[model samples]
Target: MKRRLLLVSNSTLHGGGYLQHFASNLTRRILFVPYALHDRDAYSKTARDKFKTLGYEVDSVHETPDPVDAVRKAEGIFIGGGNTFRLLKSLYDSKLVTEIRKRVLEDGIPYMGSSAGTNVSTISINTTNDMPIVYPPTFAAIGLVPFNINPHYLDADPNSKHMGETREQRIVQYHEEPDTPCVLGLREGSMLLVEGSKATLLGSTKARLFQRGKHTTEYEPGSDLSFLLTDAQ
Candidate 1:
């Protein structure tokens, strides 16, 4: 099986956009899952427009009873970025995550996701701040990959206090887990491409790897990221 997965940060899929170009030559039928959007109509329209711009026949399964059917038929699945908690909740409630795991792991259909989509590749979504913003049922992720993604990574702030913890601090708290999943801090244009069991980092700027309750070295962009995963073993 030709197994592959393209995990990216957030982006609008325009005609000449990064996602559109990457997916253009691969397949014509791209089924987009946009469960992250709380507003149904807004989500559906976004899905339609993005896929249409990418020259794909888009379908929004939010109104359908058999979203799994759509998942099974698609040549590729593109999961858009939004609220991570919301995305996982919808998948959990609909039992779509299970089907997705089988599709990518068993069937070898290429899986592509940005932001929240990338978050679901790990074993859990507890690390996401989007959780507190929206109360979604916390469930283990699909485990398509072992690493937890922290997209839109930014430096810690030393400004006047806002009272609660910052994103960086939250991530620090997440590291206290008994067995921490490798952290991949990706910028907006950053991505991790997995073919077989190897994952390669593709994009501009460096990606930070965090593990064992400590901040690891920064990985220069445009390099093979397989070492990050294999080295963990």
Candidate 2:
């Protein structure tokens, strides 16, 4: 059966937001997969509790005997955001990134992701402004989406000394690769509604679109997800 995926970093779970989107569509099947937590029990408690509150059958698998099989059976996968670097590392170490790509693109599984989750869907997660709390061998990502995603846009503190590079700066760096588009900056509360090969941003405000060595445009949310869609795949 086909499913709709909702990927996000944070949400209040009230109204028809991200949580409601998943909770309301419980019939098909739902999976709350968190990549932030290293502790298996912690991941279980965090994901299971929230999903169970919505009365859905949610399971957390820290290490699967066969990850490929597990992914194939899952109808919908909701990837929550945390540290982009950590998540990408886990994906590479566990070989879940390949399985995820197959399930979402080749197998046609509806996939949802937010923030860090969205960052990993692109070719690489280097553009994210979050600190590299953890490191993995490779910088490769799921590559389900072409453009990198910068979550929590327009809200970053200008005075912070977090080091690394800002989203804008990263995109400027990305411009070094003329072939690669800069990145897509998504504000909180914004989501991409993707069906089959088509995608559209659904929200009130427009997202910021940036390209390396190019212009930046403020695209209204729900305008047309085609930009992200084209960039992602």
Candidate 3:
């Protein structure tokens, strides 16, 4: 079975619902991961309400006695965004990381994620823009995708006088040490539609690609990005 993934940069656009893009394909039971949010119940309620309108049943894994069992039975999985460190801790503590990865990578279950969720879907969480308020078991993640993903990625703001290192500069530093996989700077309102080993850049914004010692490239919307799926294994 081939993996089916919808990795989004953000849940909401400028003024749209975060899950609005998935309104058309909403006919399955989704296991929602709400551990990232401080209020898991509230997060689940909001997600349920939004997905319910589209004819989908949503339940938070935290509500279940065995989160891994829920993932095993779920038709699809939706990982909500929040604090990356907290989210990764919950995934490892619950041992859902292994179960979810097995289902999505081996059983070919459909998966959807946004922001911090997408950050953990990659090989590592080093590229995330979130502050690490908590310590995770490790930076290791699901590895559904080979490279690192920098969600909500931004370009250098020239007008600002903050004198802080830009997002791109930080990512460049991430690769300076050694063996850092390429990072995809996915902009807001954009997503990567992955089917099998093929991935396509979706939405209006272009994705900025960061490679070690190579010039950054821009992939326009509707471009083929299947090359990114090449497994390092």
TM-score of 2: 0.81
- Listed in order, each prediction's TM-score against the native is 0.87, 0.81, 0.93
> lDDT-based ranking, best first?
3, 1, 2
Candidate 3: which pairs clash?
11-18
User: Which scores greater on lDDT, model 1 or model 2?
Assistant: 1
User: What is residue 63's positional error in candidate 2, in angstroms?
Assistant: 5.9
User: Rank order by TM-score, top first?
Assistant: 3, 1, 2
TM-score of candidate 1 relative to the true fold? 0.87
Poorly placed runs, candidate 2 (over 4 Å)? 1-5, 9-16, 19-28, 155-166, 231-233
- Predicted structure with the largest TM-score when compared to the true one: 3
What TM-score would candidate 3 get against the native?
0.93
Report the lDDT tens digits of candidate 3 across residue range 134-174.
99989999999989899888888889999889999999999
lDDT by residue for model 1 over 1-233, one digit each (tens)?
35588888654442136566566667877777878777866876877776776577766667566888877777788777778877888888887888889988898887888778888876777655465465666657887876688877666678847788766677777787687777777766778878876777877767777776565668887777776555364
Candidate 2 per-residue C-alpha lDDT over 1-233 given as tens digits, one digit per residue, 9 for 90 to 100: 23244545343222135555644644445555566555656765666666666665665546456655667777667666667788788777767888888877776676767677777777787677667888888877887766666766664468998886665666667778757755667777776666555567776556777776668877776666665555443
Clashing pairs in 1: none
